[model samples]
Target: MNNLFLRNQLCVPVKGYNRAIIYDILRKDYFLIPKEHCAILDTNDFIQFDKIEDVEEREELIDFLVNEEIIFQLSTSEQKKHFKSLNRNFENPNPLTNVIIHSNIDFRFLDLIKDQYLLNLSIISQEIDDNLLAILQKVSELEIDSIYLYIENSNIEKLDEYKKLFANYSLIFSVNFFNSKKIIDKTQLSQNIYYNFFEEEFSTYKRTLSIDKLAINAEHFLEAYNFHSYYFAKVYIDENGNIKNGLNNLENFGCIKSLTSSQFKEIISSSNFKELGTIKKKETLVCCDCEYRYMCVDSRVPSKGKKHWFHQFECVYNPYLSKWSNEEGYLNLEESGVYISASGCTIDQEKLSENFDKIWNT
Candidate 1:
């Protein structure tokens, strides 16, 4: 699938630590793109294609998805047939112009040339099965523009294996934040080992680190990852918080914070961060009212009773927050007037297509 579709979305692991917390951040801050941004589609969303009946219905859905500019994954000939059924009327083309096939099917069946649709292989983490050699062999055959390597806390030691496997491909390492070290003590032996290991291995691969809760000083973390060129901030906060337009409130309150999306845009528009590429800033906004608003920058708050930061926003599993109840002390995001969320790591697919309309669209 095209990387553009999955640009702003966070692809999280269902089994990772603090999964609930991470997902909560996603629910509040991120909007879902349709089939065109196919890179972030999980197994559950892909299965929805099975329920789609008739070419017309499929085509309609595809039309809706195309506005989102996401690539849809059609793994089988049967799926492709369904897709083709919708495209019978070539006058109105299927919005989902890009199709991704991830099965172990022969490449000949794809019938795709370089000038046409893009093709990518879904490398299952388990499929690696401790066989580094097999993984490397498979990587050699892939014509993928990027490889997604799912890295877990337990598998940190095995990352070297992946580095060697996809040495030839442009690898985007997705690190799960379970047990992620929030504090790296250079003086400590364990920290030293990890720092050395990551500094060396991640030097070659474009690292995209996923964290459940952003650190207190998120900018520091961003710098630590070398601004990664790509990073997903999955920090959570309570829904019942005061909503503001910029970081002025926090700064006025004596907080040493970085620029907000609007500020960042102004800076970039004026040729600031020129060293950081021609960065374009886009934001999604949400509004809420709570006493902790100033301290909670963009709904990212430190976990209650724990000094360590944890997600406290719209979590599907956490029934105590917004999307569950509207009682005071609980989040009621639907009631919030305006909330701003930003993504600048990839191309502005939302602007390019209108399949998905979010709060920030206007």
Candidate 2:
């Protein structure tokens, strides 16, 4: 057999307590293998099948990787001259990619951003009214890629209205109805819309991270590698037209109505406003060690300290233990020796090392 090479599209195995993950950026999927495989991936030298002592076991692993298209066989001579690697840099054409509206207001402010392409336009309001419909119609005329509408106290009659609206505005990707008093036939609802009756009302509250929210594609992987997953190119306008980077941010740039197009651009382009977007997860205290950092769209806005940024809220998933809060024998941040405070988090490195050895039986 020739020298085996891991595919460039497959990221190097990231080790966790229980397992290591090899993310296939092109396929938008992942493979979990024994964490010990991390050692195999650490070397830049080629893996020769003939040199292995555990022939049968190593062969089996190689066979599986080949079958899964995660690796390929190439001549050692060709590897030196012809091997290509993925470009890790990422850039987007649009200055603004996402917009969130907490409540409907004078949408004339949209004209400033009308020329810029938007990836997602989210409209969240407490009730559906003429004002909301007017804003929706105005937004429908724009070139937004997708629209997600969230309304509280929705009903069957509103469902029919939504059907008609969706028929007209093909860009309305999904409409989430929250705290509906009456449950309508879900079958009647279109594929894009959903009614969340039992769940809590919609709020811009920070949520815990989960595996489901992870985006496992090349675009997301590249973006997360270069910038903050949530705040990059994102703009949020609250009910009173106050503009901010995100829902939980304390800084208010300005009211949308007061700022001209040039003024708005100046505000967003300023270093202070753009500072948060530049803080990638790799710079965060606890998240830097996480295997899922590149794929995670963690909403909690981390606070920046002199040396590093830290998450104020607790995350549900523990990367050290490879366990979720819902899972059995899960360890929290404190239990794992991560102490979070207003300024930043402090890691009890000795205790963390001890826990790692205990959990993995190393």
Return the TM-score for each candidate structure. 0.24, 0.84
Model 2 per-residue lDDT tens digits across residues 1-362 = 55656455445566654567788887888888877776675444465545446878788888888898877766665554576566678978666798888656777778877777888998887776777778878887688888877776566465676676666667777676766545654323465554334233565223546665688988888888899988998888888888899877878989888888988888878888878888888788777767788888887888867688887777888876777888866789889887877566678889877886776674
User: Candidate 1 lDDT, tens digit per residue, 29-77?
Assistant: 3222333323224432332443455767656655554454333444453
Local distance difference test values of all predictions, in order? 0.27, 0.74
Candidate 1 regions off by >4 Å? 1-122, 127-136, 158-330, 334-362
What's the lDDT of the predicted structure labeled candidate 1? Answer: 0.27
